[model samples]
Target chain A: MVSVVPSLWGYAIAGYVMTAGAIGLYVVALHARARRARDRAAAIAGRRRTSTPP
Target chain B: MVSSLERVAGRITAPRGERILGWATLVAMAASAVMSLVVSPPDAQQGNAARLLYIHVPSAWLAYLSFAVVFVASIAYLATRRTRWDRLAAASAEVGVLFTALAIALGSLWGKPVWGTWWTWDPRITTTTILLLIYVGYLAVRRLSDSPARRARWAAVVGVVGFLDVPVSYLSVTWWRGLHQGTTIRLLGESTIAPIMQVALMTGVFAFTLLFLYLVTVRLRLGRLEDRAVAEALSPRLGQSAEALLEQEASARG
Candidate 1:
């Protein structure tokens, strides 16, 4: 008679997937935030340059 | 001394340097995943369920590292009253929170299979949850004041005080009888983990540390840019000259 060991691959896979997904999402969010900040800085700088007399 | 140190930091944190660091982080992460999933064999007892240890351990370790950084930076900010230190503390705290949450989630996933439950009131788990709440509160405190200096002061106080939970969470397993296992990679004595497993775990840790550094660098840059934008917006109303504002911004960026 063969003794069956329960497969835990599902839990392992879920853990790995969740870890990767969360990190990837954070990377995307950081990029979005940096882009927004860069754009805002540029917009403000442009306004200042335009308003300042040469 | 500070100016010189800031100059060095400014050079190292430049875009080109960041790109190199980013590529190195990606490579390290790939190697870590390969080692963790393929190279290392599964545990005799937990079998495949043990695989979660790679990411889970690193996430927890990185969370500890992040909070430690926040603690030191907060102290420096309070002592020197530097915005640079405050920004560093803020960035570290945010990343720490991410890793703390990741650790908890991954721990839950691991527990469900091995311990036959998704959640428990184990000392380590309970203390870790409290640790997470403390940092979350610290972040919330940052938004309480409109004045940057005031916000930093309040956040610094919380950052310093809240770090006391880190040691408590770390030693909770030994201090109390709990479902959580004791430390695996003992520094003073032989590690309980197999050699190959240790290698895989260390690789995961190194990769996560690199990722942490990259994230903090990017976040710091974002914080500087956001501050600059705010300064620019407020400059006209406050009668601050553009040259003076630019000088202040450059100093802060360092």
Candidate 2:
């Protein structure tokens, strides 16, 4: 009979989960950073755009 | 004529060279995983534990390679005052830090099966832990400094000086009769392991290296973009100053 105990597969599952989680975190970080930088740039350029009003 | 050396050197340092690095890295990582997992036969003695070598060795090599770049690039920046070199050093350090952490984790995991332990204060491991700490501090220094010139200057000096620990970390095994094995890549040439495994590991190392290059380039570009934003924001003041100087010259001539 095949054992369905979690201990047997736990490490493998954990390893896979960690890999997925780390990659996901990295992706999220990249996107968040890019978005923040974009917003910051937009704000900077927006102020410059409005203040000069040429 | 573009000498081969010059071409190779240019490719390594060029900003756009990262594109090549990105493709190479992906290819290497895929090939290595396949080679190590499917192609290479498991060791009779060590069995599955040997499998860990694929990720472990490459990450370790990356640690050395990253610090080496920091050492070399930092010196070049200090000598030339070019922000570009400093940026490369910074990028390499960040990538190196990632791999170093991976190596430590993989090492501990592998050790449990082979050495019956999860952690050890072995000299090599301790040295590596310290090396990781030093680089982390290097990154902190970069974050703490706000002025571009001062940041580069301080970071470059730290990168160059901090490199002294790299050799010590590498030699720790050789220096002490430690449980951790000495650097393994040197054995690549004469290793008894099958050629397929060799291909896998070499592919992985190259891939990781390329990946590092791509990442560094992107990060540096981001830094450059920020600088450009600041400069463009202040361009009006620069223009006004230049116009005032021109007006003063015109009045003096009259």
Q: Give lDDT tens digits, candidate 1, residues B1-254.
A: 86897787687579987788889999999999999889998777787789899999999999999999999999988787777888889999999999999999999999988899999999999999999999999999999987677788899999999999999999999999999999999989999999999999999999999999898888888888777777877786545653356445444643
Residue B28 of model 1 has an lDDT of 98
Candidate 2 CA-lDDT value: 0.69
Question: Counting only residues 3 or more apart in sequence or on different chains, how many pairs clash (N, Cα, C under 3 Å) in candidate 2?
Answer: 0
| DockQ for all models | 0.74, 0.20
lDDT of 2 at B6: 40
Instruction: Spell out the clash pairs found in candidate 2.
Output: none
Q: Record all residue pairs in model 1 with backbone atoms less than 3 Å apart, i.e. clashing.
A: none
- The residue-by-residue lDDT of candidate 2 on A1-54, one tens digit each, is 753322222332333344335534653564466466656656776777777746
Error of 2 at B14 (Å): 9.2
